[model samples]
Target: MRAMAYESYGGSDVLKEMRLPLPKVAPGEVLVKVECAGVNPVDWKIMAGGLDALMDVVHPVVPGWDVAGTVVRLGIDVPEFAEGDEVMAYARKDYVHGGTFAEYVSVPVRALARKPASLGWEQAAGLPLAGLTAYQLLTRLDTGPTDTVLVHGAAGGVGSLGVQIARSLGARVIGTASPHNHERLRGMGCEPVEYGDGLTERVRALAPDGVSVVADFVGGVLDVTLAVLRDGGRHASIADHSVLGSGGQWMWVRPSAADLTELARLADTGALTVPVLRTFPLHELPEAFELSRSGGAAGKIVVRP
Candidate 1:
């Protein structure tokens, strides 16, 4: 199998295509023939050794966690799926290696969910990590029909999903993005506010009495969140750990088949959608990493294998 891997932690320059043996399936796992892999900030961050303090990384690491693919073989005791089943997974293992950036990846059955039939391969591939992050944050905040939710970085991958999920829960959403993306946010059922100077005032103008929930996908907006959140409101951030000291939860997404199934249901019903900003062939992972690092794209970056 041909895969992109980096033997040492570095930048996109370290990623190179190489031929590797197919991974062996372990009990409670399934080997998937990769159709598409989602490129996330974390992928490149890990590549640059940003997560060295938290997670262990193995050498010759394949750096992707989100995948949409078909099962080619099932490991022992995996009774929920058979060969040729279409699935998507947040394929993060207990360690970093054998990831989804390859032609084939072995995913634990616990992390696998049936891919939403309504989404294309690229969209399905984009769903797991970003969608799961958004879903999990909103769930943790206990968002509801009457809540007014504020989403930071609302045009980016996870933030876009956060806006839609908030709306699907019947909450009125206020999303912050650049002027160019405001229309896109409005189309997704959010009241769009431009981020930067006077962000608190802008969000306040929209919510007036203050929002009932805040989901910060972009870091360093703690002050803006505190200014616009109602007294005793719930909040969480995937990017900011400081939230933990301020009565808000700091979240790290956990893989859950049940949650992925709900996201699939939402997609199939037209309540949720994944936007692909660009697609690159598996071999062009270096370019993909460069794009992801530049952070100009408004949607998910996908690599088709």
Candidate 2:
């Protein structure tokens, strides 16, 4: 199989396309022929040797976590899926050979879920990591029809899905984005706020009592997020680790097949949208990585295998 792997952690340049042996499945796992892989901040972060202390190193590491593929074979005792099932997943974080940036990956059955029928491989590929993170954040808020939720970075991957999820739960959503995305945010049922000077005041003007809940995707904006929240309202941040000093929780998204099922439903129903800003073929993975780091890409960057 052809894969992009790095013998040592360095930068995107270390990611090279080569022919490597296909992964072997263990009990409770399945082998998937990957169609598309979704790239995230973690992909580049790990590539840059940023996670050296936290991760155990093995040479020739493949760095993607999000995969959309079809099952080609199942491991011993795995019964939930059979060969030829189309599935999508956020593969477990530490599987060295299960990285999605290849023609095939072997992942645990626990991490897999059927891909939504309405979406193609690229859109299905985009769902797992970002979608699950957005779902968990909104779920933590316990939002309801009576609540008004504020989401930061409304135009980005997780934030874009979150804006719609919050609205789908019957809550009014107020989202922060650049001026250019305000109309886009509005289309997703968000009251758009520009994330700059007077951001707190702007949100306050909209929800005078204060926002019922605040979920920040862009870190370093804690002061502004807390200021706009109603007294004792819930606040969550997924970005930086800076303490907000408000008894709020710092969130890290975990992999969950159950959560992906719900997100898939939303996409199938036309209540959610996954935008692919661009797609790169397997050989051009480095170019995709460069664009991903440069910022201001319109939507999720996908890699086709």
Candidate 3:
């Protein structure tokens, strides 16, 4: 199988296409024939060694976590799925070695969820990791109908999904983004607040009493989040750990079949949409990395094998 792998921690320059053997499925896992792989900011961050201290890395690493594919073979004792099942997952392992940026990937049954029939290969590929991050963050903060929620980095992969999820929960959402992306946010039922000077005032202009819940997807906004959060309100960050000391939770997404199943249900009902901004062939992963690093995309990037 031809796949992308990086032998060392570096930038896109290190990624290379190679002919590798199909991964053997372990018990409780399934081998998936990759249809599409989602490119995330974390993909490149991990490639750059940004997560060196937090997670162990193995050389010749395949860098991707979000995958949409078909099960080709089932490992021993894996009764949840069989060959030919269409599935998707946030397939991160305890260590970085094999991954979804390949022709085939071995995924754990615990992390598997049936792909939404309503979503295409690329869109389904985009959902797992980013969608789970947004879903977990909102639910952890206890978002509900009576609340007015604020989403930082509203137009990116996670924030875009965050706004839709909040809306589905009946909460009014205010999202921070550039003026150019405001129209997209509005389409998702989010009130767009430009993120720069006067950002707090802009959000306050809409919420007045300050938002009841704050979900931060982008880092470096701790001060801004605090300013517009109502006293005693809930807040959390996926990017910033400082929130832990400030009466807020610092979150990391966990892969759960149950959570991904709920998100799949939302997509099937037309309550959620994963807008795919671009697609690249599997061998062109380095180019995909460059696009994700540019920080200009307002939607998810995908790769088809």
Candidate 4:
């Protein structure tokens, strides 16, 4: 198998294509022939050793967590799926190694879900990490039809999905993005607001009583969140862990087959969608990592193997 790996933590420059042995499938896991791998900011961050204190990294680390592929073999006691099944997973393990950036990855059965039939391979690959983050945040906030939800960084990967999921839950969504992305957010059933000076005022103008939930994908917006949230309103952030001490949840997405299945259902029913900003071949992972680090892409970056 060929994989993009870095023996030491650094930048995109450290990533290189190398031939490696296929991963050994453990009990309750499945080996998947990779079709596409989704690249997230965390991928580049991990490559740069940003998460050194939180998780252990094995040398020659393969750096990707989101994948859409086909099962080639099932590990012992895995009765839910068989060979040749189309699947997708947020394939994060307890440690960092043996990831979806390779030609094949071994994913635990608990993290696997059937790929949504309505999405293409690239789009399905883009869904797991971003979609799961959005879904989990909204779920933790207890979003409902009666709520007005505000989404920060609404045009980016996770924020874009958050807007759609909130809408699907019957909540009225207010999303912040640049002027160019306002029309796109509007198309996703959100009232778009530009993020900058007077952000609170802009949000207040839309929902005078203040929003019932605030989901912040962008960091350093704690003041904005506090300004626009109603009393006792729920709030959460994946980027800002400090929110935990301030009466808001600081969330990290966990792999869940059930939640991924709900996202697939939403996709199949046209209620949710994954947007792909660009695609790169497996060997061009360095370019993909650089693009993801730039944070300028309008949607998820995908690597096709």
Candidate 5:
């Protein structure tokens, strides 16, 4: 099988296209023929050895966590799916060897779920990791009819979905982004605030009473969000929250099949949308990684094998 791997941790230049033996299905796992793979910030973060304390890696690491594909073979213990079943999942916990940046990837049966029939492979590929992060963060908050929640990075992969999820839960949504994404954020039912100097003041002018819940996708604004939250309110972040002075929970999202299924249903019903900034072939993974790290993408970058 053809795969993209990086032998050392560094920048995108370390990634290379190479041939490797096809992975065999393990007990309780299924081998998938990947159709599309999603690129995320964690992929590059692990490439830079940012999370070395939390996980270990080996040579020729595959970086993809989000995948959309078809099941080609099932392990002996897996009875829920058979060959030819189309699915999307978060695969591989080990950044070194667990990955979907190849023609085929082996994943536990529980991590895989049926893809939404209405979505294409590219859209389905973009949902697993980012969508789950947004869902889990919102679930940790005290969202109610009178509560207002602020979402930073409102136009990016996770924040875009966070805005919609908060609104669907009956909370007043406040989202932050640059001028270019203001209209889109408004369409998602959020009051858009520009993310810069006086961000708290801008949010105050709109909400006046302050937000009850804040979900920060951009770690740089933790202080600003803390200032904008009302006393006793909660703040959650997918980024580092050690510097955040709030008492609310600092969150890290792990893959969950139940969460993915709910997100899939939301996308199928037009309540969610996974925007794709670009698509690339498997061999061009380095380029895809570079684009994801460039900080200007309007949506997730997807790769197809």
Candidate 6:
């Protein structure tokens, strides 16, 4: 199989295309022919050795977590899916290696879900990671119609999905972004506020009594969260671990077939949208990594095999 892998940690420059053997499927896994692979900021972050302390790294690592594809074969004792099933998964494992940025990948059944019929291959590939992150964060906070939720970094990949999920649950959403992204956010049912200086004042103007929930996708804004959050309000951060010290929970997204299924249902029902900004062929992963690092765009990036 043809795939991209990095023998050692560095930057996008370390990624190289090569021929590798197909992965051996474990008892609870399935082999998938990769149609598309979703690229997240974490892909580049892992490539740069940013997660060295948290997860063990194996050499010749293929860096990707989100995939949308078809099942070619099932492993022993598997009964949930058939050989021809269309699927998508947040394919994170116990260690870093054997990922979705290849012609094929082996995914555990626990992380796999059927693709939403309403989405294209690229859009479905974009769903597992960012969509699951937003869904898990908001649902854990128990946001509902009676709550006013504030989302930081609302124009980016995860933030945008969060806005839609919160809206689907009947919550009024206030999101932080620049002037250029405000109109687009409004289309997603989010009231947009400019970030940076005076962010607290702007959010307070929208919810003077303080928002009932605050979700921080972008880090370093604890002051704003503390300022605009109501007393005993819910708060969580994916980017800021220091939030643990300030009465807010810090979370990492887990792979769950159930949660991913719910997100797919939302997509099929027209209640959620996966915004894919651009895509690159398998060999052009370095360019995709650079694009994600620059933050020049505000939607998900995907790679085609």
| Predictions: Cα RMSD each | 0.7, 1.2, 0.9, 0.6, 1.5, 0.7
1-305 in candidate 2: lDDT tens per residue? 99998987787879888888899988989999999999888888888887788777677888798999999999999888999999999996553534899999998877889999988999899889988888898898797798999998989988998998998889999999999999988889899999999999999999999988888888888888778888878888898667457777788888887888888888889898888889999988888888889876668999999
TM-scores for all candidates? 0.99, 0.97, 0.98, 0.99, 0.96, 0.99
**Stretches of model 6 off by over 4 angstroms after superposition:** none
**lDDT of model 4, residue 136:** 98
Residues 1-305, model 3: lDDT tens digits? 88899999998999999888899899999999999999999899999999999999888898899999999999999988989999999999899989999999999999999999999999999999999999999998889999999999998889999999999999999999988998989999999988989998888889889989999999899898999999889999998999988999999999899999999999999999999999999888999999999987977899999
Poorest 10 consecutive residues of model 1 by lDDT?
51-60
Q: For candidate 6, what is the TM-score?
A: 0.99
Cα-based lDDT at residue 77, candidate 5: 84
Measure candidate 5: CA RMSD.
1.5
The segments of candidate 4 whose C-alpha lies over 4 angstroms from its true place after superposition are none
Q: Is candidate 2 or candidate 6 better by TM-score?
A: 6
lDDT of 4: 0.95
Give the range of the ten consecutive residues with the poorest summed lDDT in model 5. 240-249
List per-prediction Cα lDDT, in the order shown.
0.94, 0.87, 0.94, 0.95, 0.86, 0.95
Residue 259 lDDT (model 1): 95
| Greater-lDDT candidate between 3 and 4 | 4
Off by over 4 Å in 2: 95-97
In candidate 6, which residue pairs clash? none
Clashes by residue pair, model 1 = none
Could you tell me the C-alpha RMSD of candidate 6 in Å? 0.7
